[model samples]
Target: MRLANRVRELRARFRLSQHELAEQIEVSRQTIALIERGDYSPSVVIALKMAQLFKEPVEMIFYLEEEQQ
Candidate 1:
């Protein structure tokens, strides 16, 4: 399974720069970049806060893709 997130889309939709989003989410800009590039995954608590801040369902923001690696 591959972990993916719609962070870029949401950030654009919200007109938020990576730094801005990171501020709102209480994380570092690099962390946001990492998440956006699919290099790292946020924990459940952080994910929940991110979804709540954007008023989106967690599933809509993050998902698991099934594929053989």
Candidate 2:
């Protein structure tokens, strides 16, 4: 399974640019870009921070998606 997230969607909903979200979550803009592109899985601390900022549960923001074979 691959990790997937709704960060981009949520970020848009909050009217935040990736840089803005990254600043609030204390990460680099590249890190936010990586996460949104599913190229990186963030640490638990990062996930929790995003959850808090988005006012959503971690599970709601991220999940496992079965990789297509």
Candidate 3:
């Protein structure tokens, strides 16, 4: 399984820069980059907060995708 997120799309939809989004979420810019790149999986609380901030459902923001064999 892979942790996939539409963070870039949500950020763009909110007209928020990476730095600004990171600040709002209380995380580092590199953390945001990691999340965007699927290198990191946020905790459930953080994921819920992000979904709330974007006014979207959690499923819309993050999901688990099957990895290629």
For this target, which candidate reaches the highest TM-score against the unseen true structure? 2
Candidate 2 per-residue lDDT over residues 4-56, each given as its tens digit: 99999999999999989989989999999999999999999999999999999
User: Ranking by lDDT, best first?
Assistant: 2, 1, 3
Off by over 4 Å in 1: none
Query: lDDT of each model, Cα atoms only?
Result: 0.93, 0.97, 0.91
lDDT of 1 by residue, 1-69 (tens): 999999999999999999999999899999999999999999998799889988999999999998676
Candidate 3 regions off by >4 Å? none
TM-score for each model: 0.92, 0.97, 0.91
User: Which model is ahead, 2 or 3, in terms of TM-score?
Assistant: 2
Q: Rate residue 64 of model 2 by lDDT.
A: 97
- How many clashing residue pairs, candidate 2? 0
Of the two candidates 1 and 2, the one with more favorable TM-score, higher being better, is: 2
**What is candidate 3's CA lDDT for residue 16?**
93
Residue pairs with colliding backbones in model 1 are none
